[model samples]
Target: MSSPRQQHWENVYSTRQADEVSWFQDDPTLSLDLIARSGISANAPIIDIGGGASVLIDRLLDAGHSALTVLDISHVGLTVAQKRLGDHAGRVTWIAQDVTAWHPPQDAFALWHDRAVFHFLVEAADRAAYVRALDRGLRPGGFVILAPFSLTGPERCSGLLVRRYSAAMLQAELGADYALVNQQPQTHLTPAGNRQDFIWCLFRKSAT
Candidate 1:
């Protein structure tokens, strides 16, 4: 059974080259910078939510992260990423599941990273589900690098409505167990040469 979200993304990946997508980036510089600032070791367990066909996996594998998981709803997107990785694909654990509905492994990831995915949860219930998953997925001392459209960013992307956020808004939404460690504003130049505003937040799960 194909979900509408899955079908839409499947078409997006099938009809467009990975780099041809509007959100495509040759090097995920902002993401890498935030991850580096989190101070996690290269061998730390990490999950890239809604990773799909993003090249973050390539960068992570190159940097020697051992426990890596990439989860997305679209099978086409994941298949393309696996094909791009070739033999290196075996090094990664790929799960094709909707982020809002999937149950994450218990305290499994040292770091959880999401870009553009959070903003897409326009419905309050979906956003709540995302937070629940986050709380369940990360280790107590783990870090989360979340990147979403800022309040000033586009109201819609890829034909879907999005809920933009500031660092403060994101913090409030995630609740008290996660504390904001660092944040940065990014001006991303999409593959189509359009500018998109984004806020990247680094949060640590409280040890208490």
Candidate 2:
């Protein structure tokens, strides 16, 4: 069952180049900076959700973080990334699954980074499920970093509707078990030569 957003992303990756995506960046420095500043172990496992075709994975590998995973619903996007990374493909694990249905491995990632994924949930149940999984999947005291369309950001992407969220709104959606640590603004350059704003937030899992 392809979600509307999933279909939209698959179509985008099938027809557009990496440089044509709104989230495309030669270096997603803002996200990487937040991750590095989180005081987490450099070698701790990190997973990038909806990481399709993002250069962040390349940057992560270049930074000496060996345990990295990229999960995306688009096979074409993953293919492009594999081709771009070349021999380095062997170093990163790639999983093709709709994140809402995927389960985290036992004792898995220490950090989870998701940009522009959760906003597409649109439904309370889906969003709740995603957060529930995040809470359960992350190791105790692990970190979760996410970026979503701001309340003032674009309402659509690649011809599909998107739900926007504010920092507080998103934190509430994740519930009280996760503590919101940091929030910042990010400007995204779209392939069509437009800029969009996103709110990036970081959360830490509470022992409770």
Candidate 3:
């Protein structure tokens, strides 16, 4: 039997089209821009947490990034993306697992990206596990780009409660070892024509 968490997302992916989802972005323009500005090499190993069927990987491949990984709890979503990628899908490492419980390969990535996922982790223990995975996966001096619901954003998303964050709160959660590189406020317009506020944070892990 699948966990409720897995089942919830599987159901969502099975029923929704990429364009029908509120999180849909025809082209992740902002995300692409931020990543381009990260100064990492095209060969840098990068991972997209909760990337389920996101076209970001396609764009990255088009941009000539050789190493890419996408992780999501919903196997259905990954399947959709793989089918969409056709033969090119083999270039990507796909992991279908819960982020909180998943173990990271040590120093595996030079940049870690997450969008529309962190806020769903409303539990302290889950958040702690996430941090540990992050620490283990990212190389020293790596970049972490997170887009979370801002304090002014909706209290809930996708019929689930979310933990909104202020810049300070996010910084604290990352600890002093991470140096803030940049931040941008986004007023995202969902595919459904609803508006959601978001804060994009870029941090550089200490080279220690």
Candidate 4:
């Protein structure tokens, strides 16, 4: 028995071709650039929240990142990625769970990356739960890369409402524990040739 959220994603992945999804990207250039900017070691643990069927993990593995974890609410989405990776998938960890309800290991990851996911949490409580997971799962000096719909982006995606954000709004959500490192705006061209605005931010957790 899947929750409404889980069921929605499951249906989406099961019915639609991965590359046809609005968020599909042939090259995750911005995400890779930010991860490199973080200067984490190849062996450092990194987790991608709501990674779904994204090929970012494939790129990370190719770059010699040995410790990689991808968490998505839809099993079908995870399966799509796993199948695409073939045997290489065994080297990565796949977790099928919702970010808001997840209980991640304490200080388990050196970096956390999310793209086009945070904005979907239109509810304040859901955002708080996600932050709690981030606080608990990330190391003291971990890096966080979050990309959400920009203020000028769509108010809805995949038939669900979303909350657009600015860099300041994102910083407020993370609170004082994380220091904003940098931010950039991107105009993403979807598979359907639609343009979507996204704001990407990098933050470092307090070492204390």
Candidate 5:
């Protein structure tokens, strides 16, 4: 059998266009709100990890943030995003690789964003690898925004199990190097019109 994580997301996106994905929104207004409130430089380097076929790139560009990169493990997803952006796509950088194994450039990004990705790392080792990637990819004082399933949220997504977390539990998992600056509860509408609660956390890299 294929790995559950790979199969689940691949099938999820395979049947849907970018707009059909459950997390899809005409505008990720909440995400934009968080970015604006982060107090980071307008020209800071921002990266969307596991961005795949999301509309995040479009919103990021429209906001006038030029130093942008989208990284994902799916080539088909990247192709769709590239097609959607047309010529404007050239202005953004794209990386197709597993986030864990991918080595980012030194002090590469000032902001990092992940939605519906971290919860998929159900195994302890996998989760640790993801944290290590964060350490390597972010610059000093970089901000990280994550939206993961809340402890009280649904147990499954894309037909696979996810590791849910509360704000404190998530911070504990990520460790003391990152200080949680803000968090909010979010209710997302599934294709079936059901609501799934999630915790959106913003963490700033601590000056150690």
Candidate 6:
């Protein structure tokens, strides 16, 4: 039996066209740019949290990134991406699991990227669990690129409440072990032509 969180996303992906979703982005330019700014090599291990049907995976693969893992709570979402990728899908690793509950291999990733997922953790415990996973999965000196709803963004999305953040708030959540490197505010234009505010932050883990 799927968890409520998993079931919710599975239903969303199963019923909606990928490109028609509210969070859908055809280019994913900011994500790609942040990945480039991380300075990791093409072969470095990277994981995309809540990757779902996002085309970021497709862009990464096209850029010669070899070690890529995409984790989504929804199996249906993963399937959508796989179908879109076809033969190229086999090049990436797909894991269907909740971000807070999943256990990652220690020091397994060189870079961790999340876009619009962290904000969904409305509870303190859930946010802490996500941080724990981040600490365990991301290697020392690794980069973290997080794009969550800005403080000015919407209070709700997809029938769920979200916790918005500024760069300082996000840095506080990550704590001192991760140093904030850069931040950019984005006004995202949804498929329906509505604007959503996002705060993108890049942090590098302490090498010690």
lDDT of each: 0.92, 0.86, 0.92, 0.97, 0.85, 0.95
lDDT for each residue of candidate 5 in 113-170, tens digit (9 for 90 to 100)? 9988898878898888888888888988889999999988889877678999888988
Cα error of candidate 6 at position 41, Å: 0.3
How would you encode candidate 3's per-residue C-alpha lDDT over 46-120 as one tens digit per residue? 999999999999999999999999999999999989999999999999999999888999999999999989999
* Clash pairs (backbone) in predicted model 4: none
Tens digits of per-residue lDDT for model 2 on 1-208? 8776577778899887898787788878888988987787778999999999888999988889999999998878988899999999999999987888778775487899999889888888878778766876788888889898998899987676789989899888987877898999878887688989899999988864
The residue pairs found clashing in candidate 2 are none
Model 1: pairs clashing at backbone N, Cα or C within 3 Å: none
Index of the highest-lDDT prediction: 4
How high is the lDDT of residue 168 in model 4?
98
Q: After superposition, how far is residue 68 of candidate 5 from its true place, in Å?
A: 0.4
Instruction: Score every model by TM-score.
Output: 0.98, 0.94, 0.98, 0.99, 0.93, 0.99
Per-residue lDDT of candidate 4, residues 89-185 (tens digit): 9999999999999999999999999999999999999999999999999999999999999999999999999999999999999999999998999
As a TM-score, model 6 comes out at: 0.99
Writing each residue's lDDT as its tens digit, candidate 1 over 1-208 gives: 8889889988898999888887888899988888889899988999999899999999988988888999998899999999999999999999999999989988999999999899999999999999999999898989999999999899999989999999999999999999999999988898889999999999999976
- Candidate 4 displacement at residue 104 in angstroms: 0.3
- Show model 5 residue runs off by greater than 4 Å: 1-8
Candidate 2 displacement at residue 208 in angstroms: 4.2
Mind giving the per-residue lDDT tens digits that candidate 6 earns over 1-208?
A: 8888888898888888998888999999999999999889999999999999999999999999999999999999999999999999999999999999988999999999999899999999999999999999999999999999999998998778999999999999999999999999999998989899999999999999
After superposing candidate 3 on the true structure, give the runs of residues whose Cα lies further than 4 Å from its correct spot.
none
Candidate 4 residues lying further than 4 Å off, grouped into runs, are none
**Clashing pairs in model 5, backbone N/Cα/C closer than 3 A:** none
